[model samples]
Target: MVSVDYLTKPLDIFKEMCRILKPGGLAIMSFSNRCFWTKAISIWTSTGDADHVLIVGSYFHYAGGFEPPEAVDISPNPGLTDPMYIVYSRKLATA
Candidate 1:
């Protein structure tokens, strides 16, 4: 999905993902420095890359029913343009 759609209603989408995922399944959210800025959420457009991780992590946390989210910086170049990251968590077996 596009950044605007996903970032704008992150919690709702996250909850839906959790609902459909089987127990022990993983939900992964990946993003990069690239996006359509005008269509993205204000927080998403305004924050630096590191904060983006926290913002996405917070979505997992607040949505409740998943494992604590973990963040990975899989950026090809740490300081270069288009840095990539993933914030992921698994559905709880009991969820």
Candidate 2:
């Protein structure tokens, strides 16, 4: 959804990711403090790194069939370099 409000919707894409994955599968999405603000989605640019993690977490939550999303700090050097985070969720196992 490349509209005036959002550059892209990760939620839409995450839904597809959930649908494609097998039960008990894992989905990982990475985000960083580095991005072209003008080219990124409004929220991505408007918010800080922490909020970005919650935003990505929401994608997994609303996408359905996934366990709680978790955030991983993978930055090599927090102060020396740009910060990075890996947000992931696992597809729920079939009952």
Candidate 3:
């Protein structure tokens, strides 16, 4: 099984995943919500944990090579101020 860290650009990782996945097979990935207070604190504090990888909205938009992802709020009462977001996406056909 191939696993990559979230610090890697989402697009590059997605591209590689597309290459490895069997046709019609599904790949699952998780991204960090930049607005999450915990992430902010970690960054400000610089805890230096290897898990501290920042994935913001723009990363998906530009560096990550993804468009608007199909999203569902697992959390109750999702508002603009909410700090965490969970997104799920699937790879389309490869050219």
Candidate 4:
């Protein structure tokens, strides 16, 4: 999936990412200020792009097996086009 806005159970997806990744593996998920609004979840459609970053980050944090995720702004031109962002988390390394 290109975006999590369409996910009905995003946290569950992240949990599975953690479960399947080897220690220290990175799991990166990205989103933008764009999506199929009708298909997106209510919260995603209701919130703005900045909030979208936080929402996606929460999926990683609450999923329970990854390091804190980072949200990066990668929009090509601030206002010229749709804004894009990425939230990535690393699976915690096993000792």
Candidate 5:
């Protein structure tokens, strides 16, 4: 039941996820892109002009829930919109 805003760092979120997950549990994370026009507009409309604080590549090792990470593509157009990829990762079982 933990909800965080875009202001939260990706590492912090990943750490929180690690804390909550069981030894072999899974976690799904969806993130927006600053390069996306819609997000860019939101940023311009907002005060900070900050669209996204985290990038897509940070999910490699930090996000561990899916043995083979799943990528969910959110971009309407590959060329027009900035692609947003949601990753589902699994935590490794420990001895």
Candidate 6:
């Protein structure tokens, strides 16, 4: 997941990911600080990097059938260039 802009309905995508994943499998979604502004959703384009993590986490929570999502900042240089981050969730064993 380089840019979330391509997703018209993110929740649906999350649900689909969960549906296809094996028990305890991880669904890791990553994104950068930059994206095609014209193609991104207003929330994605307007919010800061930290908020983007929250937004992605919400998708997992709302989609259900998964454990709590975890956020990670994997940026090599915080301010040198576009920062990179990831939000991952695991499908429940019983899901």
lDDT top scorer: 6
Q: Report the error of model 5 at residue 17, Å.
A: 0.6
Which of the two, 2 or 4, has more TM-score?
Answer: 4
Two-way TM-score contest, 1 vs 3, winner: 1
Off by over 4 Å in 3: 1-6, 31-68, 76-84
Write down the RMSD of all candidates, one decimal each. 1.8, 3.9, 7.7, 1.3, 7.0, 0.9
Q: Count of backbone clashes for each model?
A: 0, 0, 1, 0, 6, 0
Candidate 4 RMSD to the correct structure: 1.3
Measured with C-alpha atoms, the lDDT of residue 26 in candidate 3 is 51
Q: Least accurate stretch of 10 residues (summed lDDT) in model 5?
A: 48-57
Q: Can you give the TM-score per candidate against the true fold?
A: 0.89, 0.88, 0.40, 0.94, 0.47, 0.94
| Cα misplacement distance, residue 14 of candidate 4 (Å) | 0.6
TM-score, predicted candidate 6 vs. hidden true structure: 0.94
True-structure lDDT of candidate 2: 0.79
Root-mean-square deviation of Cα positions for candidate 6 versus the true structure, in angstroms: 0.9
Q: TM-score of model 4 relative to the true fold?
A: 0.94
Candidate 2 regions with alpha-carbon error over 4 angstroms: 1-7
Expressed as tens digits, the lDDT of each residue in 16-65 for candidate 4 is 88999999998888778778888999999888988888898899889988
Give candidate 5 misplaced runs (Cα > 4 Å): 1-5, 32-54, 63-68, 74-84
Please report, as a residue range, the 10-residue window in candidate 2 with the lowest summed lDDT.
1-10
Flag the better candidate by TM-score, 1 or 6.
6
Residue 86 displacement in candidate 1 (angstroms): 0.4
Determine which window of 10 residues in candidate 4 has minimal summed lDDT: 86-95
Candidate 3 TM-score over all chains jointly: 0.40
How many residue-pair clashes does candidate 5 contain? Answer: 6
Off by over 4 Å in 1: 1-6
**Which pairs clash inside model 5?**
64-90, 65-89, 65-90, 65-91, 66-89, 66-90
| lDDT value, residue 20 of candidate 4 | 95
